[model samples]
Target: MRVCLIASGSKGNAVYLQSGESRILVDAGFAARELSRRLELIGVEAQSLDAVFVSHEHGDHCRGLGPLARRYQLPVYMNPETFQALPSLGRVADLHHFDTGSAFTCRDLHVETIPLTHDAARPVAYVVETREGRIGIATDLGIATRLVRERLKGCRVLILEANHDETMLRDGPYPWPLKHRIRGNHGHLSNGDCADLLGDLLWDGLETVFLAHMSETNNRAELALECVQRVLEKQNLCRPQIVVGRQSESSICVSL
Candidate 1:
């Protein structure tokens, strides 16, 4: 399986995962042009994508879906409420609706959805099966859930959220209401939450973990790494090799 994080953050997020003839995009948050350039940089063409699986209706996750789907005539998938919430996406040729916690398939890939704890209408994370190994993509989450733990328990590669530092978020520049929401049960998960979750996984050595959707305004890469590494050390678990995905540049394609 080849995993490439094209962009990740609060502003926008997208990841490209491909195995054999199956090319799947987790989110299409950028414009068609930007997505095209990023894919080309990683040696893929937009038209080659078999399907686009959307996580939520948030603009940062599905902003570019309309244009990209229209351009490539690609099939798009999302839950019913999210699909209805989307601003009249004018360019979509096909739209498939799946329940938030259901399993679905597209071409040569198998996807099992894990419900998310966000304010959006029925968001989900996906556990994808490829020939090489299983990959789990979880982001924009608030607190970790039992469903999420079950889905991600055995993933060979994980792209999960490490969106903020709890203290920083509590004492940062965000207004009072926003801060309360962020630290609530349905807001984003802090770095500490990520560490706690990682401690539960029976991960093999150097298990690839892409810390994605980091809050640029509220978190730092080194700090995020430190938080997660400490927990792994305590549990005598292998410190999963971690890479922070950026919100702008496309990262090197990694294979498992």
Candidate 2:
């Protein structure tokens, strides 16, 4: 399996995943042209994508879904609620609606979907099971539930949300209500939240961790990495290669 984060931040979010003969995008946040450029940066053509899996209807997660899926004639997979929420997506040639907790196959990959704790109409996360191993993608989630931990267990690669630092969020320039919303159970995860959750999920087979969905105004990459590392060090566990996903550029392609 191969994975790359095309973009990760408040501005937009997209992830590229390829396994066997399957190539798919988890989200298409940027415009079609911008998504194409980013894919080109990683030597992946947008037209080569076979399918798209949407997490929710948030603009930052699905803004480019309509244009990209239409232009590429890609099959889109999402829960029925999320599809209904995307009336703005206009007409898509192919659509597949999978139940939130069901597992489905996309060509050579087996994808398991789990509902996420977010304010969207119906948000979800994905665990892609490849021949090599499983790759878990869970972002825009407010908290990691038992079901999430269960679904994500045994994954070789994890893309988890590290949305903000609690102190930074409290002291940052954003107003109180917005801050409260972000700190809410249906909002986003803090750095501390991410670290604690990761500590519970750490294991020997975990090869790489991508700290994703960071807040530009309230969190730093160094802080997110340090927090997770500290938690692992205290437990004397072997640390995985942790990479911070950047908002402006594609991540180094990871293969397993």
Candidate 3:
């Protein structure tokens, strides 16, 4: 299994996953042209993707979905509510709708969709089963629910959210309502929240961790990494390589 975070952060978010003979994308946030360029940076071609799985209807997660699918004629999988929320995505040639919490196969990969607490109509997170093990792609979630913890257990690679720093968010330049929403139960996770959740999901086989979906305004990549590193240092059980996902470029590809 190989995973590359093509782009991450509030500006746009996309992930590339390849397992066996299957090459899939978790989201298509950037415009088709920019997305293509980022894929090329990671040595992946937009035309080579087998399918795209959407986690929600947020622009940073699905802005390029319409053009990408239309141009490439790719299969798009999302829950019915999310499909409905994306009315602007007119006539994607192939559409596969699955209920949240359902499991589906995309060629060589088996994907288990888990419901997420977010502002979108129907957000979801994916756990893809590969020959090497499982790769969990979960971000944009506010609270790490019990179901998320259970489903993400034993994953070899985890792309988790560490969106912001609590103090920075409280004192940031954003308005009150926006700040409150971001700190709410259905908003993005803070660095402290991410570390707490990571402590719960640690295991002997957890080889890699990607701290994704960071806030460019309220949080720095170094702060996010240090927060998680502190948690890892407290315990000697799990010591996975941590990679911070960036909005401007692709992360180092993790092949397991």
Candidate 4:
């Protein structure tokens, strides 16, 4: 299985996962044209995508669904709430309504959607298992739940969010109310929040970890890494190969 970061952040969120003859996308946040170009760089064509699994109605996660799926004739799956929020497309439908809880099979790939905490109607984090191993992709969430920690347990690869630096967000230019929303339990995960969550995770099989969905004004890769690195060091866990996902571009495919 090959996992590619198409994009990640408050700006946009997308991931391309391929295993054998199957290829699926976790989100379609980028513009249709830009998404096609990014996929091509990773040796995939828009028409080759098997399906799209949406997490919610938030534009950062679903903005391009209508345009991209329609243009390429791809199937889309999501929860009923998320489905209702999108523009109707011939092949798009709700995953929960389909009776495929957080877990479903799309071709040879097995995907599990872990429920998420956010302001959206219904949101989720995704864990994809393939012939290669298990990989979890989670972001745009605030505090980690017991379910999330369990679902992501032992993932060979992890794409988790380290969305902000609390201090930077508080003292930086954004207003207090906006800052409260971000720091709220229902909002994004801060660097410290991310570190604390990873500390409690069982990391035996974990190989790689990428800090995704960071705020441009409030975070730097170095800070995100420092937080995780400190926690990993204290726990005596395997120093998982770590990378930071950028908002403007996709990250290189890391071994999962």
Candidate 5:
């Protein structure tokens, strides 16, 4: 199994995954052209994607779903509420709806949808199992629930969200209400929150950790990395290969 963070940030987000003959995209937040360009950067052809699994209806998560799915004639999978929220994607020819907390198969990949806490219509995170190992994707989430931690356990590669730094968020330029929303239980996770969650989820088999969906204004990659590293150090845990996902380029493709 292979995983590549094609792009991740407030601007847009997408993840590419390949297992055996199956190729899938977890999100297509960028425009169709931009998604194609990013996939090309990673040596993947856009037309070769088998399907797209949406995590939510937010523009930064599903903005390109309509055009991208239609252009490639790809099937899109998401919960009914998310599908309803994305009215623009109604024209997609092969839209498939699955309930949250359900497990489904997409070609060679086995996917389990874990419900997420976010200010969106039925947001979800995915735990994908391949022959090599399990890969968990938990982003665009507020608090990491116990279920999220349990579902993500034993993953060989974990793509987790470290959206903001608490101090930077409080001191940043955003207005009071926006800041409150971001710090609220239904908002994105802070670096501290991410670190705390990782402390509980870490296990011997977890080899790679990708810190994703960082805020351009409220978080710096170095700060996010430092926070997680501090937690690991305090626990006297062996550090994994931690990679920070950037908005402009693809992360190194990690294979298991």
Candidate 6:
């Protein structure tokens, strides 16, 4: 399995996954033109995607879903509520709605949907199983529950949320209401929260970790990396390859 974080930040987010003959996109937050450009940079074509799996109804996760799916005639998978809440996604040729917590297959890949705490409609995280091993993608959630830790176990590569640094967020310029929302139960994960989650998720087979969905204003890549690194050091665990997902570009493709 090969995974590339196409883009990840408050502005937009997408991920590309390939295993065997299947090429899947986890989200399509950018405009069609921009998404196509990013895919091209990573040597993938927009029309070549097998399917699109939406995590929620938030614009940063699904803004381009309608156009992308319509253009490519791609199948879109999401929970029922999310599909209902999505803004007028025009004439999606193939819509497959799965219940949250159900497991489904797309070609050779098996996907398990785990419900997440987020403001968007029926938000969920995906744990994808490939021939090599499992790859987990869980961003945009505020807290990591026990179920999240369990589902992420044994994953070879994990794309987990490291949305902000608490101190920065508390002192940042966002209005009080917006700041409160970001730090609330359904908001986003902080660096400290991410580090703690990483400590719980560490295992022998966890080969790579990508810290994703970072806040542009409230967090620095270096700070996020440092927090996770500190946790690894405290636990005396072997350091895994860590990549910071960027807003403007695709992350280097990682293979398992």
Q: Report the CA-based lDDT of candidate 5 relative to the real structure.
A: 0.92
Better structure of 4 and 6 per TM-score: 6
Which consecutive 10 residues in model 6 have the weakest lDDT in total?
231-240
Task: Tell me the TM-score of model 3.
Answer: 0.99
State the lDDT of candidate 6 residue by residue for 1-256, as single tens digits: 8899999999999999999979999999999889999999989989999999999989899889999999889999999899889657778879998999999988998999999988888899999998998999999886798898888888889999999999999999999999999999899999999999989889878889999999999999999999999888877566789999999899999987
Worst 10 residues of 3 by lDDT: 229-238
- Per-residue lDDT for 65-95 in model 3, tens only? 9999999999999999999999898899899
**lDDT against true structure, model 4:** 0.81
For model 6, give the RMSD to the true fold. 0.9
Instruction: Give the deviation of candidate 5 from the true structure as CA RMSD.
Output: 0.9
C-alpha lDDT of residue 147 in model 3: 98
Writing each residue's lDDT as its tens digit, candidate 4 over 1-256 gives 7877899888888988888878888888888888999888888899998898887778888778888887877778787776766654335432334332457877887788888887777788888888888988888776798888887887888888899998899889988888998998789999998998888764767777888888999998888898998898886666788878878888988644
Residue pairs whose backbone atoms clash in candidate 3:
none
Say which prediction, candidate 1 or candidate 5, comes out ahead on TM-score.
Answer: 5
* Model 1 spans > 4 angstroms off: none
Candidate 5 residue spans exceeding 4 A from truth: none
Looking at candidate 1, what is the lDDT of residue 2? 92
Candidate 4 C-alpha error for residue 53, in Å: 1.0
- lDDT string for model 1 (1-256, tens) is 8998999998889999998878989999888899999899999999998889999888899889998998899999998888888866775778898988889988778889999998888888999987777888999887899878877888888888999998788778999999888888788888988878877765663368898999988899899999887887787556666888898798667898
Tens digits of per-residue lDDT, candidate 2, 1-256, equal 8999999999999999988899999999999999999999999998999999999999999989999999999999999999988888999989999999999999999999999889999899999999999999999887789999888989899999999999999999999999999999899999998998898888889989999999999999999988998888987666788989999999988999
Worst 10 residues of 5 by lDDT: 231-240
lDDT of 5 by residue, 1-256 (tens): 8899999999999999999979999989999999999999889999999999999999999989999999999999999999888777759889889999999999988999999889999999999999999999999888899999888898889999999999999999999999999999899999999999899878778889999999999999999999999888876556689999999889999988
| TM-scores, all models, native as reference | 0.96, 0.98, 0.99, 0.93, 0.98, 0.98
Off by over 4 Å in 2: none
Best by lDDT: 3
